[model samples]
Target chain A: MNPAFENITSLRAKLAARDITPTEVIEALRARCTQVEPSVSAFNHLDWDTALREAATADASLPLGGVPIAIKDVIAVKGQPCTCSSKILKGHTAVYDAGVIERLRSLGAVPVGRCNMDEFAMGSSTENSADGPTRNPWDTSRIPGGSSGGSAACVAAHEAIASLGSDTGGSIRQPAALCGCVGLKPTYGRVSRYGLVAFASSLDQIGPFTKTVRDAATLLGAISGRDPRDCTSLDQPVPDYTASLEQGVKGLRIGVPKEYFIEGMDKDVEQTTRQALDQLAKLGAELVDISLPHTNYALSSYYIIAPAEASANLARFDGVRYGARVPDGKDVLDVYSRTRALGFGNEVKRRIILGTYVLSSGYYDAYYLRAQKVRTLIRKDFEEAWKKCDIIATPTTPTPAFKLGEKTGDPIQMYLSDVFTIAVNMAGLCGLSLPCGFVQRDSTDLPLGLQFIGKAFDEATLLRASHAYEQSTEWHTRRPVL
Target chain B: MNVEYVAKLARIDLSAQEIETYQNQLGSVLEHMDAIASLNLDGIEPTAHASPVFNVLRKDEIKPSLPVEDALSNAPKKANDLILMPKIVE
Candidate 1:
């Protein structure tokens, strides 16, 4: 088997047996990248020399030792250009490692490449990337979901063994589902966000994209824990996520939210999702019909709350600081305005404006504040649902990956793409998307993702259920023909 | 609804075409927000953050800070250990 296609767990076993060295793995992946990366457009920047150098000295005994992990461009990796796939930070290299990178490095993982993403992680489709949209590996004509599209695509296409992607309103899970891989968005505060470029501070959490559920658990365990640098990181103890992988979902109640299977959703997606639930039931898991009454309001609340926070978080990108600065203005205000005008893409500007407007005078009470209150209701809905079920299962996306340029002209349509996944972020819970099945579109097999949401800080159960379902099915074994 | 005003508040200079485009797009996006606007959230407390964290304090001690050069490495314009911005006190 190609080392590039091998999951991290198997690679670890191989490395332990001395069947292959870390240097050989990097060399194999680099060769695979050379062959497939052009078609995938998954990476914004790749440094084989640096990755190889790290691999040569890697201690294979460490948990993630010598594993080449792709990093989404949003996270800071020392000496790497953490552009967030935007023109604003085109030449800005990270001066220090992000909190997750530091953790991964300490676990002996090699940070190999910078993956492409939405500019400032503002869009659902990776099409908003300044570098260009990362095409779905399954069908080059379709979009790989964003803002972690590159991270998901690279893993699916075997360009990287595993990659880290942040989830802010489904950036990680949605893309992972569309790309046919395992994507986990740990609960809010489960992973430190110190080095992650802020999009929505309250909603953002970094997790992993891997080829299997066990790999996801390994990566999540390595990167998760409290960090003094980020106070939002929970002080809760980090559990061994892999320890519970074999625990079958024999009596676990999986909540099926009626709102998630709504009218107008693609019939194929619903059928595939229902079939996956049936498979889980056959495996002895109970599918309880549940209602998250406030689900309808999650998208509206997220749009307001995320942008309001984004406008504030993004205010730091002025002319004098790090990143590209246009020097046309005579004064500070002119420079700030002119630099931003030329730097940001259309979607970014729209979000910034919407964010500013919502947080601005007169509109705050009506928009931002109201959205936050509605957020409280959304969180309460989850709290109530958890009483009836241990985990919530739903379609990761309403439909399979859509063709490129299909929704670019329509922003609302792009926003609607993340309808099923956004509520998980709003409630600040742990959500995992693994390959459940496939939908044939235009005679091509497009993958469908089944999302399993666990309560806040309850990733162990989430992984347990996901692993149970994944091992029972052949979907996770199926790879896109790149 | 004023696209230019919001752009000004955001410190971005939108082109006439962009302003026109955003005016229509923002209007429609906000129309979607009406879903939450009509909800009865009178007694619900607004959640500023999902994680229940307050002002996190640590022992007051000087820690190693980023070296000046590394801090200023990405600065657009720098002079003698200070980031040089446009003259503010003109």
Candidate 2:
């Protein structure tokens, strides 16, 4: 069997049985990537030679031993370029391993390639990348939902067994929904953000894009835990996420929020999500009708807070320390301005300016501060809803993947694409998206996603419920014929 | 929304055309954000971070730091062991 298309669980078993060596798996992935990469464009960079060398000496005894995992460009992997899909950091190689890379490396996982993303993780669509957009494998004409678009698309196209993606505002889950794969964003502090290029500091969490919920659980366990380097990382004990996967969702209360099924949502997406909920109810899980009243303000507040934090975090890119620098600057200020202007993409520049405006002298209270307080209300909504249910369910996106260049012309239209997924980030809750069913569009079958939001650090229950739902359906088994 | 002034504060140069485009786009986004202005947030404590951890202090023990060469490896301009920057004193 070709290890390229197999899930991490089966690959781990195959590696242990010595049916295939790590080198063979890498070779299979290389062949697959060579075939599909030109059309999919999932990676910014791929170092097959390095991956092969690492695979040659891989110890197959460890948990993830010899498995190749694709990494998003935002996370630092020593000797690999950490571009974040922006021109500013072009040619800048990471001198140290990110916390996640260190953890994955310890388990003998070979980090293979740098997956593409929105420049500085600013946009919902990978169209914001300077490296070019990653196309959805399901329908080549449509976009792969983004920031983590490449990570999701690569897994769906069988370019890699599993890959890592960071979710700031649905970057992981939304794209996974569009690309028809399993994506999870752990509770805010559950994973270390030491090496993730900060998009929105308080909202960012690195997670996985996989073919199966089991693979997501395994990947999440390996990368979680407190690190001294990232002060914000929770000091909680890391639980074995896969341990509870088979527990099923019997008698568990799955909250279905009324606020999510808003007007103007696609009929097919709503129907698919409802059908999935019915399947969960049929499987002995209790479905609770719930209300997260402040949901309407989530997008507005996220735009304010995220940009405000981003404007401050991105100040490090000023031409002096690293990355590109324009040569003919008459003064320091000139150098900073010219370098940044030339380096950043349009979307990145837009956010930076917007961020700067909200945090500017007179506007801070009206915009930034008010948005933070609104964030409290959003979090409280989740806090209250959790009292009635074990987890919450919603449609990951209002619609399936749109055609490329569909929303690029209008930023608000692009931002609206993430309306369903952003509230989870605002509340700092863990959320996952898995394929529920498919909707036929233009003579092609496009997949729909069902999102599950869990309490803070309660990834175990989230995984259990998701796995139970995933197994009862065959959506996870469908693959894009690239 | 003074797009030019905001761009100046952001230290990124925007062309006349880009500024006009951003002015319209950001104007609409900020208008959308106006939904939060009328909220009654009395006694609501702002959540700066989702994780409740604060003032995380590590032991002030000596640890191996990144070597100067390694640290300056990605610098745009560098001397023997230092990153060269434009003169701040004019």
Q: Write the per-residue lDDT of candidate 2 for residues A347-451, one digit (tens) a residue.
A: 989999999999999999999999999999999999899899999999999889999998998999999999999999998999999999999989899988999
Docking class of 1: high
Model 1: lDDT of residue B12? 99
Model 1, B1-90: lDDT tens per residue? 899988998999889999999999989999998988678887899988888889999889999988889999999889999988878996
Least accurate 10 contiguous residues by lDDT in model 2 chain A: A261-270
TM-score of each: 0.99, 0.99
Point out where model 2 deviates above 4 Å: none
- What part of the reference interface contacts, as a 0 to 1 fraction, does candidate 2 reproduce? 0.89
Per-residue error at A424 for model 1, in Å? 1.3
lDDT of 2: 0.94
What DockQ does every candidate get?
0.88, 0.88
Each model's lDDT comes to 0.93, 0.94
